[model samples]
Target chain A: MIVVEALSKQFGRFQAVDEISFEVQRGEVLGFLGPNGAGKSTTMKMLTCYLPPTSGNAEVNGFSINSQPLQVQEQIGYLPESAPSYNEMQVEEFLTFIGEVRGFSGTELRRKVGRVLELTSLQDARKQIIDTLSKGFRQRTCLAQSLIHDPPVLILDEPTDGLDPNQKHEVRELIRRMSEERTILISTHILEEVEAVCSRALIISEGRLVGLGTPDELLSQSIYRNAVTLSVSGKSAEALLEDLNGLEQVYSVERLEDMPSGALTVRVFPKDRESISSELEQFLKKKKMVIEQFFVERGRLDEVFRNLTLGN
Target chain B: MKGLFPIFKRELLAYFRSPVAYVFIIIFLAANAGCTFMLGNFYDSNQASLEVSFLFHPWLYLFLIPAVGMRLWAEERRSGTGELLLTLPVRTSVSVFGKFLAGWAFIAVALILTFPMIITVHYLGFPDNGPIITGYLGSFLMAGAYLAITSFTSALTKNQVISFILSVNICLILVLLGWGVLSEILNTIFPVWLTDVISQFSFTTHFDAIRRGVVDLRDIVYFLSIIIFMLMTNVVVLESKKAS
Candidate 1:
């Protein structure tokens, strides 16, 4: 439901966001992965119409950001980074203000505010002043403000930062809950979050679009993809290594450890999308070698992300 | 216009919710009464008109108006709420005008509280209330003009102190342009027409014109033009900053 085309933003000599283009379909939760100053926020700002792109443009729900900003804004709920809020206001007051400004009135305004407070789990702290709230509650309040209008599109920048593990899980669950029917785009430096909730993700670095695909697609690009680990007991390490080396579809087997309990651990790399698990299991059964641990490894995107973003 | 009520109500409530409105009003009343009684010699002059009470308005607004207006946009920028406010469905002009009106209304409340001075004068002597009424009108309009200027300066930076000082300096210049001593010297150093033109733009001259009991439409227009001009510039400044 969001189309960002060749969007670029520059602050004088510094280019904050280079030409980046991508689309997010309805019911998709797109994770924006980037390091600090990677232009992720800038790109989101352009889409939200908070910042005019230095060049190029974006469109939300078929309305061009440059020509129809208000229309575009009306459809998007933005939770900005740091979740800046009016510190002097109470939680309910701030949510009500947001609802009122969006043109909700009377029972409709009350219901909208009520829905958001429930969605964000902010009911207990509704009457508390914002400045007095703890950080997690404050963040939830900001999230409630964005969700108060129930807009179709949500652009949340670092929605789960600085929270403890439980609070982070709560916020992530909240985003997941909201992502069922809405097109949601979230920018986060937290790597695992992409895999946890996002159906697809876009990675940007140094103000440019560096990677874009599903979490699995990105993981498959990792150097560790499809590799398998073989650990066994009641076997001679050298003989097992030799037989594993001769197997088809197996490019290389690197022995990692020889345990005191007669256990052997070896990491086997496949050759070109091959699977040698069945043959290896059959050979072990023929020799009557006990299997301790055997499993194919999925690619680790953390490795891929570090390699891709840090390499540049 | 549609977004006006939310912004106006929020800002007005903000004023009362903080100590800023109460402290400012108390100080404003004190200064107005102090200037009238101590400096203007209310009893000594036996003056039926409220010339002394209104006299402090131009000077009072220099510090007080800026104090009220400095937080208008500067606080929003400092706390990063400017992005949230600007990105709302409301137009920029609506925010600017609504906020300006809130500050104007606060000052209007303070001015209205100066009724004791009027009551005192009425009890003391036979006074022409026409000139006193126009004087209040002049004070209210001049306060609005000062607030508009302060609001514009406040929009320029996130620093409230800088906003306060910059607006105070600008308002001071506008005030001095028509003060008797400054304009007298201007008439000598520059061409007489230049002094007249500069004095025409001063807060003092227009306010004094209204105090003379003649509510000339030109003087009213001049103050209004200043308010409108400053407000439009405030909108332009905010809009330009959004790009930068």
Candidate 2:
């Protein structure tokens, strides 16, 4: 649904988005992860035809951003970073205006407006002025505006930036539910959101593409991937650390702080990130170790995010 | 062009949606009445012609028209709604022309509200209706000319105050160029041909001719050319923002 080739934008002497290239397919939710000022919003602006690129090009629904921007705009439903809407307009009025601009009229425009209001759960606030609404409601209003046209591609910049946890969960659920047929490109700094809703994650830092893969693929790049963590009470901490470190499959064992119940906790590292769980379980049984808790880590996204975004 | 109607509708409704429209209309009517009755001495002159009332329009529009136009683009930029508006499947020229028409239509509404002045003139004596009708046409076109300049200045910055001040200064220069005192000063320092050429660009020169009921094509074209030139420049300014 979207293709970008060497898309670059430069403002004076500062390069906001460097020759970045990527593509998004239908039914895929791509998470745009970047540190602040990493050009995520800039890229989305180019894709939505809001900002023209300095060099290279991008296409949405096969319409080029440079030569066919109006057609490209027709294919996109963009939620700008600020989620801007007219403050003086009522919620229903705003959506109706957007619907009309999107080429719907009469009963169809009203139906489109009503559908988006219900989709965004903005039914009760329909008649209220936007300036009087809360931030989450305002965000939802903007979201509803984007959805009014029912475009196949959605480009949302920080869609959940100011929402509370429950609102965030609802928006994520909304994105997840909508991902069955549409191509979504959402820019956010929240790692958990990518894991929860996005089918693929693209991480950029310093205006450069650093990593692109699925959440699991990116997590596997972390140092903690597939590592086993065990809490034992029968053996001394020092003895267990030495014994765990001596196994052929184990590369190292770092002793962690004791649990609240006074059981010693340690993280066991595999030699090659392969599963040493079965072999270690047999070894523990032979050693007569009393295990309090034992589990293999699925890897922490924050660790992977920090490692990828924070310069090596 | 398909996008023009929706944008124009939204912008015009946006004016009435806030207190700006009512306050602007009230202040405009009150000020026009105050100028015509108190300052221009409409009753004492005993002239059935609306010359006294029409005399103050250029001066009134100097500040009033800019007040109506300054928010056309500056508010959009400040509130970040320009991104939303431009990203719609609309051409940039369509949005620009539509927005300018909406502001022009708003000033038309304000102009139409001054109908009682005509009723007053009709009740008192036999006034030359030709000049009066032409005077209103000239005023409406002049308001559009001034509004186009304000729209250009508004696109230059996101600050409404700056946009208001810039357009006021530009409109002041155009107004002063044809004023008697300024042209007299220019006559002493420059050649008559040069002075004529400079004042020809002034709003007062063309508007004054139309106010006298001439309805000359040259005068109408002058006001329309200003509107078209300024609106085209406004479109360029907005498009440049995307590149720079």
Which candidate gets the maximum DockQ versus the true structure?
Answer: 2
DockQ per candidate, 2 decimals: 0.69, 0.83
Error of 1 at B78 (Å): 1.1
- True lDDT of residue B29, candidate 1: 90
Off by over 4 Å in 2: none
Model 1 Cα lDDT, one tens digit per residue, A116-158: 8888888999999999999888888988888888889999999
Q: Specify the highest-lDDT model's number.
A: 2
lDDT of 1 at B141: 93
Give candidate 2's error at residue A96 in angstroms: 0.8
**Model 1 regions more than 4 Å off:** A236-248, A251-262, A273-276, A283-288
Residue A7 in candidate 1, Cα distance off native in Å: 1.0
Candidate 2 achieves a global lDDT of 0.92
User: For model 2, how does the per-residue alpha-carbon lDDT over A266-297 read when each residue is reduced to its tens digit?
Assistant: 99988877888899899999999898889997
* Predicted candidate 1 versus true structure: per-residue lDDT over B1-244, tens digit per residue: 7788988988988999899899999999998889988998888886788887777789989999999999999999999888888877888899999999999999999999989888888898889999998998998999999999999999999999999999999999999999999988887899999999999989999998887788999999999999999999999999888788
Model 2 CA lDDT for position A85: 97
